[model samples]
Target chain A: MTKQDTRPRPKAGPAEPDRPQRRKAAAAYPYAFYLPAGIVYVVIFLIPTVMAFYFSLTRWTLFDSTFVGLENFADFFAEQNLSIGFRNTLVYAVLTSGLKVVLGMLLGVLLTSRLRLRGFLRSVVFFPVLVSTVAVGITFSVLLKPDTGLVDRALALVGVSGHDWLGDATTALLSVALVDVWKGVGLATVIYIAGILSIPPDYYQAVEVDGGTAWHRFRHVTLPLSRPATYSVIILSFIGGLRSFDLIWTMTRGGPGFTSDVIASIIYKQYQAGFYGLSTAGNVMLFLVVSAIVIPLSWFLGRREIA
Target chain B: MRTFRRVTAEVVALVVAGVVFLIPFSFMLLTAVKDSVQAAELDFSWPTSWPIVANIAEVVSARDYVLLRAYLNTTVLTVGSVAITVVFAAMAAFVLQRRAGRIGALANFLVLSGLIIPPAIVPTIWLLQALGLFKTMPGLILVEVAFGLSFAVLLFRAFIAGIPRELDEAAMIDGCTGLSLFFRVIFPLLRPVTITVILTMSVTVFNDFVNPLYFLPGDENATVQVTLYNFQSQYSTEWNLLFMDIVLITIPPLLAFVFFNRKIVAGMTAGAVKG
Candidate 1:
């Protein structure tokens, strides 16, 4: 414990003002308080990030490495699955984030409205968010097994046959995206509900005074005011979808010939195959992609938020 | 008549959302209590006889009680990480809020970047290996705290801004200095946000899968999420046991969420909504 001496020293110089001395003393206190967290964060997180940049440029193993410059990046880029992985990553992010925003807003509005059992319904929707993603992935994989599974059984009752949801290349990524939305939409809805409820009733009353219909009130007041929540949902879900791995790994393992693979999963695959340096590069690229999108989008959203 | 129609419409919407959200969980529950023969069918039919106790017994005791070990390991990891995260984040956030300087601004940026950027896993593994902490519980605990620190710090900073600086001065005037002033005067005032951080961070760490998988790889260090991998194999067909495993692993956190539902939701959305 590096305890700072807190005893006030006798003033030696009369020219030094008390306020400046106090400010200096207060400044030193913050650094002391911040030291534990700063040291842990920098050592564990920041250093590894810097090390990743260096390691990404080397052909490394557990023991030794040779400088490979941009070869690892080139190899990662030239891999046959890279294009599909990139496309799938974008598609998955857009699909999940879009659906989460739309569905979450609708549900948020409904739950905040005069709905029966709204509390219970909110709990039910949020229950899955607490469950382990791997558990959800496993449970959904079994349910959507296409044959003799509960989902298919329910579909069959409607005279519809079910396909192998997780097995089919065409529907694999889409199906997983839907599950991602399912497991996640609860948080989005909660955020939207908070956002919507925070909008003063005066806004709605103004529309009502104008003889606005429900649609008009919603479109004119609720939708625009809830932009912050919508922005958050899009950013959170989109970044989550881009970096998604656990559920995909548990559910499909990026199977059906890399049709459903994202960049993160691809990176994991490289690591699993002992391509540590290549995977480190992949990780860096994933970070760059996420930062590239999120930072600018946040700035754009922040600007609009203020305006 | 109009009121009746509106109520009916709301009812229909609630039922639809409820069914969609809960069907998968109900399926998991139904499958977990059935015999192997029935579980293999994987339909929504009621089990002829409930074997929940038997299934739980077998799952808990399987393979040298590995699931039980996983439960213990996960509990330790969650508690350890949450304690560290809350304390460190609170201390840092307290300072960052009270003192705005260049270092504070840089710290804020680093914290925000942690939220936005995906962690580079391979290099982290190498670093951990170099420190002789790889594949160890402490290593995984440190990783969890590092990852969760950013969010906790952000939440606390938001909450701490509301606390006045006069309290600090008042405490200092009473001869309560650095650590004592924080512990005696400041930390107790941060009760609401502290609970929020504790519950949220605990849940996050408890439910985390990737960090545990990558950092702590061996069976001895298996967390609850890693135990799911043990339940599934390339050709295994024991759906009943598997579902039972899922149920057991899910119960603790699920109950925590249900009990602290409001706090968790408030804590999670606090930053997004307010900031």
Candidate 2:
């Protein structure tokens, strides 16, 4: 409702004498159009983010605060699980993003090829992406239960023994990361498919004309051309890996002694323990870590993308 | 031989993919119908007795019909948030795409930050409490909209960039000023992207567990996902009832995917592919 064209528009664009001022006032793109979204975003998102910075420096309940800077940050870093949480976050991000990049491109290539039941196969791979994470976590948890679970049972028939996937600390983080990939690789595949499909036929034909085999065509053509898709997948899934809480919460609760805990879960557990100040600090740390990785990566990716 | 090999590879891929993805769903469906003790085994075996109807009745009727309330709450949350997300995101994206200057660049930065930054939860809860929206549906709805806006804005911007500026010029020349021009002309043309936003945002909000859990706590106000989480604990040993709840809550997305599969896939892929 606060949307009215009152402010003077910024002076830019071509200096055409034929341009009319009234045309600039077109409703199709009003400064007021940004108002509704801007207000909600500022109030609900941006303001709180700023407030989180202040509150992270304070030791207060929802009601009152005592400004206790640096102490909360120190405690958060000093916590035993902090290192594991940070390390696991990196491992999970790298593992999921790395695997998805490779597997998704392969599936993208396969699905796009002259193949039977490709549609069904694509849907089958993508279906898990839409399902509830908690449901998938619970299902996989049961399916991975040491010996009786289907995964172990299935492995037994092949005369290979299965370890306690989620029960052991070594495998807990790895198992959850694999499930994250399973739930996500569909998306990466689709993105890669789109990227791969967008490449003109000339590129592949050129490769073939060079006496190149299918491997040469794929290795040379498909992979490099899909840089944008790879960037998209890496950032999306990697950030997801960094901030993931729900699946980890549902599956392990960061258990096996918090071996599988990530930054987001650590924040949640801190909050659950009523460590409001510490939790806020944890969130700030998480934001920094994510921005640290993503900002530079985006800069690097964008630099390459433009040239 | 080449054709045979291609077909053979396709068949093999389908089989492997089918088993990997489809088995979990089958297990969820099968386990939901079994009796408690039998369900606890968590094997892939079928139920000895089909108590699906009875199981559905119990899960629905459990916790003083909280699941029913949760379904209603979730429906309202999804509709309210997705509706706002579509309209607001489209409007903002329209402006940002058309007049992308300094302010637009700043706004874009904020939007991108929303995607990567893990929201500070305790502070969010504190702020919501100050606004008297804490543990309330409207508050949670706003939270969802806030979180959803970035992706929605990006998607709409990509789609709107494709809409010709000539339409705007023509509309403005006809005495359609400000909101009127957008409402009459540009907005109508945004149908494809709008549907994409609606379906994808609907799924995101409906399946959202964390926000509702953090912001809208309490029994009566529980979202369907929160109910699923709650049921997981109370029915920790009662796998049948627990999975029954999972199946119930999972139906909405399943239905959405089945019906609007193309739009959902397009919306998700559009941003990644094009951008």
Candidate 3:
């Protein structure tokens, strides 16, 4: 009986098997089914991305073209605003991402607490995210207008005059950055909501039973558990801030003598000025800068996940 | 004593946060119904009279009814782009995840590249022209679809991971082929996430300004956001109509949230919450 049971079943052989055939059949659907999407992925995305690299090396407009290797890239770095654009992109990315994470965590805690009118409060906080960037920019521009705007009138009520929020070169970028934060922090908040909500009740209960203070509970249990959400908030918000354009454009059009010009707006300005090749090079640089920063950062974050 | 102190602190914190976010929006609504001088003054006081109807009418009838056309264009663009993006992305993600090999890795990377890289506008322009789609609605639709596909794919892949593999096997045993199997079996299971993707993508495409500004530059192709320029002239700004324009463009998405804010947040964080 033991010898008979140890013998290989005839049904398990390559031709005679149910399991092997099913496994092979499972494998077949992948390639055959994935083919159409794969073809589209190549034609629409891959081909164009490769072509962009090539075009950055050429001088061209809507209809004109000529090969000019490295000249476009050279011109891009030499522009007066190029360095400023790079500096502003990094600065905005850091400021916006840093602030959003801190605020999001704070709000996440507050809203998730047994607070009053939680539903209404959450909607109010997330309200800015729904409005169009163009509309938001325009509304803020009017509201923050130095003399006639509400900000100034309110300041006047306090015996202080409002400063030129969007007019002065110094304040323009800062103003835009603030609005970006306002429009965006909802995303971080929502992420934090999910993260915090998922924490098992027993963890909190255990902390409380151990005579944990609110601070102690937050420090050990809430903070550690929400690391993934925090990481995501930092990465997504930072990347978004790096590529910000619409709000900046609608607010000031990178004006006040180009003080507010981000890389995207600078590229658009170059395009407007008929320097197509240079603009293309700027696009390439923007792509490289974001990729270089984000890929490494994601890898760093991913390592934290595994550990 | 500690509990009392904590409650006081919480109340103060909540009020401060609420005021900081609320005041700007309050001013916006206030200005929307004010006359030009009053609007420019930025007073937070109630309107001297109700100009809501009058101001909105002016905005609607501005630039030879341009805002109406923009509304139509944006509706078409948003509906078209979201429809294409959700279907294509869902299908691609399903295939990519089901298959595990070089092609899968390459597709995943290609999609990932979109997340980090800014679009190469010049090349995209050229590509559209090369395909004879430049300055066309179809061109804009394709552009939106290409850019949007990656995020949609990411969302779909993450959500699909939660579904059990046994369903696929059970369906295959019932004699369903490729499209039928996906549409009949897999697709229905994906409805919750698909709704989320649809809502988020619709909001994104509808709110998009730059893509429409560049790719669809002509007056006939103007989206509602682009129509803000109708009040903006090189010579002088029309403050009243412009403010009204801003208010008008804001209504749809604002209304969307009024109805579906909770669902949107839930949908948005579905994967993040799980992972």
Instruction: Place model 1 in a CAPRI quality band.
Output: medium
* CAPRI-style class, candidate 3: medium
User: What TM-score would candidate 3 get against the native?
Assistant: 0.92
Arrange candidates by DockQ, highest first: which order? 2, 1, 3
lDDT of each: 0.86, 0.86, 0.80
The local lDDT score (0 to 100) that residue A243 gets in candidate 2 is: 86
The per-candidate TM-score of the B chain, in the order shown, comes to: 0.97, 0.96, 0.93
Every prediction: chain A TM-score: 0.91, 0.92, 0.88
| Superposition error at B126 for model 3 (Å) | 0.6
Candidate 1 lDDT by residue in tens digits, A212-272: 9899989999999999998888888878988999988888988888989988898888898
Off by over 4 Å in 1: A1-28
**Where does model 3 exceed 4 Å of error?**
A1-41, B229-238, B273-275
lDDT of 3 by residue, A182-275 (tens): 8888888889988998899999999999999999889999999998898888888878998899999988988788888888998889888987
Each candidate's DockQ? 0.71, 0.71, 0.55
lDDT of 2 by residue, B42-147 (tens): 8889799889889999999998999888889998999999998888988898889987667889989988888888888998898889899999999999999999
